[model samples]
Target: MLNQIIELVADELNLDSKTLTKETRLQEDLNVDSLDVVELVMKLEEEFNIEVTDEQAASLKTIEDILNFVEANK
Candidate 1:
């Protein structure tokens, strides 16, 4: 599941999979903007069939955060 999320985000962001890891900062390393984050979350919600609260959404700062969230929710 972590790998799949990473793959999906990497593909959407046009980032190299090698450069993306659980600890990678989504905005800092991937150059994702606010809009990109929103889109990414939406995609994740759809793909994982989980709802992300606004607060949870706001707290997502890194790939690890996303991975943890998905694991916890799923």
Candidate 2:
């Protein structure tokens, strides 16, 4: 599941998957701005068939956060 999420995000961000890790910060490491995060959240929702609350989206500081959220909610 983690790998799948990585692939999904990598594809969405047009990033090299090799550069991503659980510790990678979407904003700090990937340079993902607010708009990018918003779109990514939408993609994640569609991919995982889960709803991410605004609070949860704000708290997703790292790749692991996303993984954990999806694991818990999906």
Candidate 3:
């Protein structure tokens, strides 16, 4: 699941797949801005068949945060 999310984000952001990892910063390393984060989250929800509340979404600060959310909700 983590690998899948990384691939999705990498594809969406036009980033090199090798550059993304557990410790990679979404904003700094992936260059994801606010809009990108929203879009990515939406993509994730679609992919995972889950919904992320706005407050929960706002709290996502890392790749692990996303993975944990998806795991917990699904």
Candidate 4:
């Protein structure tokens, strides 16, 4: 699941999956802006068949956060 999330994020961001780590921050590390984050959330929902609320999306700061959320919710 972690690997899948990393791949999805990397593809969406046009980045190398190998460059992403659990500690990678969505904004600071990945340079993800608000629009990108919204798109990412949409992609994640489509991929995982889950609904991520605005509050939950706002709380995701790092790759690990996303992973943990998906693990818990998926």
Candidate 5:
């Protein structure tokens, strides 16, 4: 699940998945802007078949945050 999330995020951001770590920040470390995050959430929803609420989306600050959310919701 973590690997899938990393791959999904990397694809969304056009980055190398190997470069991302659990500590990587979605905005600061990955350089993802607000619009990118929205798109990322949409993609994640589509990929995982789960809906992430606005509050949940807002809480996804790091790679670990995303992994935890997917793990809990998936």
Candidate 6:
């Protein structure tokens, strides 16, 4: 699941997978802005088949947060 999430985010963001980790901050570390967050959440919803609320998306500050959300919600 971690690898899948990393690959999904890396491909979506056009980033190297090696640079991504659980601690990677979406905004600061990866330059993910509000639009990116929205887009990412959309992709995540598609890939994971789970809905992400706007508030939940806002609370995702790191890769670990996303992983946890999917793990719990899925």
Better of 1 and 5 by lDDT: 5
lDDT of 6 at 10: 96
Model 4: lDDT of residue 8: 96
Q: Taking the candidates one at a time, how many backbone clashes does each contain?
A: 0, 0, 0, 0, 0, 0
Candidate 4, pairs of clashing residues: none
lDDT top scorer: 4
Q: All candidates' TM-scores?
A: 0.91, 0.96, 0.89, 0.97, 0.94, 0.97
Of 4 and 5, the candidate ranking higher by TM-score: 4
Q: Residues 3-68, candidate 1: write the lDDT tens digits.
A: 898898898788778778889988777778888888888998999999988889888998889999
Evaluated against the true structure, the overall lDDT of model 1 is: 0.87
RMSD of each: 1.0, 0.7, 1.1, 0.5, 0.8, 0.6
The whole-model C-alpha lDDT of candidate 3 against the native structure comes to 0.84
- Local error of candidate 1 at 31, Å? 1.9
Query: Which is the better candidate, 1 or 4, if ranked by lDDT?
Result: 4
How would you order the candidates by TM-score, starting with the best?
A: 4, 6, 2, 5, 1, 3
Tell me which residue pairs clash in candidate 6.
Answer: none
- Encode model 4's per-residue lDDT on 1-74: one tens digit a residue: 88999999999999999999999999999889999999999999999999999999999999999999999999
User: Which 10-residue window in model 5 sums to the lowest lDDT?
Assistant: 26-35
The C-alpha stretches of model 2 lying farther than 4 A from their native spots are none
State how far residue 73 of model 1 sits from its true place (Å). 0.7
The runs of at least 3 residues in candidate 1 whose Cα sits more than 4 Å from the true structure, single-residue gaps closed, are none
**lDDT (C-alpha) at residue 43 in model 4:** 96
